[model samples]
Target: MRRFTRPKVIPLLAKKPPSQLPHLSPIPNPSLPQPPQNPSPPSPILTLSHTQNHTHLLTFIKTHIKNPPLTPKTLLHFLKSKLHHHPTFTHLDFHVFNWASTVDSYRHDHSTFEWMVCSLANTARFSELGCLLSFIVANPCPCSDGIFSCPRTEPIFRFAISAYCRVGRLDDAVRAFDSMRKLIDGKASVVVYNILINGFVKCGEHDKALWFYERMVRDRVKGDVFTFNILISSYCRNSQFGLALELFKDMRGKGCSPNVVSFNTLIKGFFREGKFEDGIEMAYEMIEFGCEFSSVTCEILVDGLCREGQVEEACELLIDFSRKGVVPRGYDYYGLVEVLCRKGNSERALEVVDELWRMRNVPSLIACTTLVEGLRRSARIDEALEVMGRMLEVDMVPDIVTFNCLLQDLCNLGRTEEADNLSLLSSTKGLELDATAYTILASGYSREGKKKEGKVVVDEMLDMGFIPDLATYNRLANG
Candidate 1:
């Protein structure tokens, strides 16, 4: 579920951008692409002069290109800064890109080619993107003028293929890929194959993804870990967990080691089919394979077992993970504690938190608070007090309400001395105390018959404005 964040692009031309732009040599008289067959089709570029906006575009192009025989670099700059970045003329980039080819000496290099492609793809202008790709095929880069094809060519098509895949235009993607394979000097990179496979999978064409993966293999392209991960996920999604597992084994057999994601996906797949034991085993295997844990990995294991009413087993597995020292520092165990507490196994929850904390897997603040409340409800005042102290030692203070409640619990258990020490310690850790905190401590000391201690707290309370009225102040100090 990795979300792809497209880089911020120009404002308007995202409609259907090319992963690259046109260079002149491909086909003689390469006409502009026909607009898509939908309502409100874009005005054909040749017809731009008929519209009011075309006047501005024409003027801007004329103004920017006073010098003849435009170089690709200069033209790219003008297209990007003068038009791409223009507030009013941003969508007019393709027009100028085409117009630049008409210049006698101007030739589109990889730079303008890439810019135009990205612009078309960003705008989701697939049909135009296809034409642009065709134009590139007809007029290969100047570097390809010698025996070798342009190195930049594959990258441009790769970007274009990914863009096509993004829009579910797999045919266009495959067409672009085919054209690229014909032009590239050697085998298509595994990366290119992966994009198409992943694109097919994302578009819900599992069988096609598999077909493409097989083709990639036949091409003798060494499939990387990502290749296996995608197909593994695809098989799992198709209810072919057996195949997913087979691929998992095949992945390792091929000297492509499984990473955390590899294990996590299968573990999750196992759990999705209610194969809890298998899921847990997959997690342990992750550790054995030297793949470090992600927080989500732990979450999946814990949540899966808990769903099956194996809460204690979940607890043991996590403790084992913590002891194994594979738990990522970013992995938070709050949900486990919260679940255990809600299940009335507060002691087990406390044990889990304590064991992990002892190993320096500091429980998040909410986990500490939840565990403290769980302990409080069970009348485990001593453990609650100790948990509170540990939280402060780590500079994690509870909310004031929880803090006061714990203090009150300590006093109620005749541990007022411990309560007072805690109050002082907590303040140093940036735990703000209120009238209720001081009042609770003062009352605790009064019950313990230590007037001197009680008076000290009362005086402090008065200085801090907790003793609001004269009568309350006198009552607190004299108690």
Candidate 2:
């Protein structure tokens, strides 16, 4: 206790060591030996897993089945439960099912199997669908009497064959029909042959579609309204409007009433060949035949009339149709406006534009530009400016075309000051003044001997990233 008291009395002073601390010695590196590397294990052959392959098989089946229509989700669930974890079940499962059930289920349920067959054929997977037909040929489904029936005996098979033909898979479709014929002991029905003919027509294989028609007549497949409609539509689509008209006559001669679709197709075909009057006549004929004119028919009439510079007639027709409570749906009034404007009748065109606006449909940028250009060309500069202002007021920003039109009009009218002001406004609004607009302004300035002003405009144009064209450059150089 006395020593501690004395140490405390010394103010607890500690001794100072050298400036640097002692360093520890480094350890020696150990020499570690490397182990021998073993050869890599052989990679497994990467076939699809059972679940993945089953999913693909189900997808294939669902794709083929459209009628007794099983969706992909339903088919996947069915396969998961029915073919569970099976490796060999590819797209051929449904094919086997269709064939086997056909023979066994004739007495149990004929309609259900037929429905399945029709559904399978409508699926775009022709190759997988062909598998079903092949299975049917090998193992024919039975008839109502419980006797094994040939594939041709089933109407569903015929429907499938026809669907294939419609989609331009004519060769495979023909093979299916042939298989059915052999199975049915050469007793193919008129309905089956008609389907094949219709398929060819639908696929734009007009020649083949027509060939099938001839074959049907040769085989005495009863020509009905359905048969005529298909062939007529095929001719119309193939630009053979005259042939389509002839077919229409033939149908009427055979006491088959021409349906609205037939009339519409003919009218559209005529319009396609630039025969507006003929198309209009067909529309009239549709009404005479007690076939009500659809909106599509009205549109065809309107488009044809407008294209032929008879926009006044088109507008009258539209107004008349609207008054008659037959407002044409999906009809473009913009096209009408364009045709009218192109004919140098922008005032009449504006009437159509106003009509569309009232109907809550604004004309497109193209129609707006066309109208403005027409107004300018007619020396109606003030009216064109008013239209541009109205467009902007409607929150329609002026595109490059709008600016070009306005600039040209202003320059043409010797209003270069206004044009220059407008160009500045365009730049401030982030609207790029194109080379045409610049050239117009530059030429206007140069023509008045305002060389300095023209050079300033040229510099501004270059600053705005527009390279003046040859005319603009020559004018600046000559001036």
Highest lDDT scorer: 1
Worst 10 residues of 1 by lDDT: 6-15
lDDT tens per residue, model 2, 1-479:
01111111110112123332111111122344535544864211112334455456545544554444233344445444544345575334343343223221112133434544664665466654675566455444434223335343547667777677667788888888888765554446767777788777766678987887888787766688778878878887777778888989988998888777788788888878887777777766665567776767776788778767677889876655554444544455667777777778888877766666556556666777778887877777887886776676566667887678788778777888788887776566567667788788889887777878888888777677675476755555455
lDDT of 1 by residue, 1-479 (tens): 21133222222122222333222222113265645456865433422533456656666666886765568888888987778778877876776676565554346768888998999999987777777776677666666666677789889999999998988989989999999987678899999999999999999999999999989989999999999999999998899999999999999899998888899899999999998888888787777777888988989998888878888898899898889898788678888899888877789998998888878899898989999998888888888888888888878978999999998988898889888998899999998899899999999999999999999999998889776799998898777
What CA RMSD would candidate 2 show? 25.7
Model 2 misplaced stretches (Cα beyond 4 Å) = 1-128, 146-155, 181-194, 202-205, 218-221, 237-240, 272-274, 320-330, 341-344, 350-479
Off by over 4 Å in 1: 1-52, 446-455, 465-479
**Predictions in order: lDDT:** 0.82, 0.63
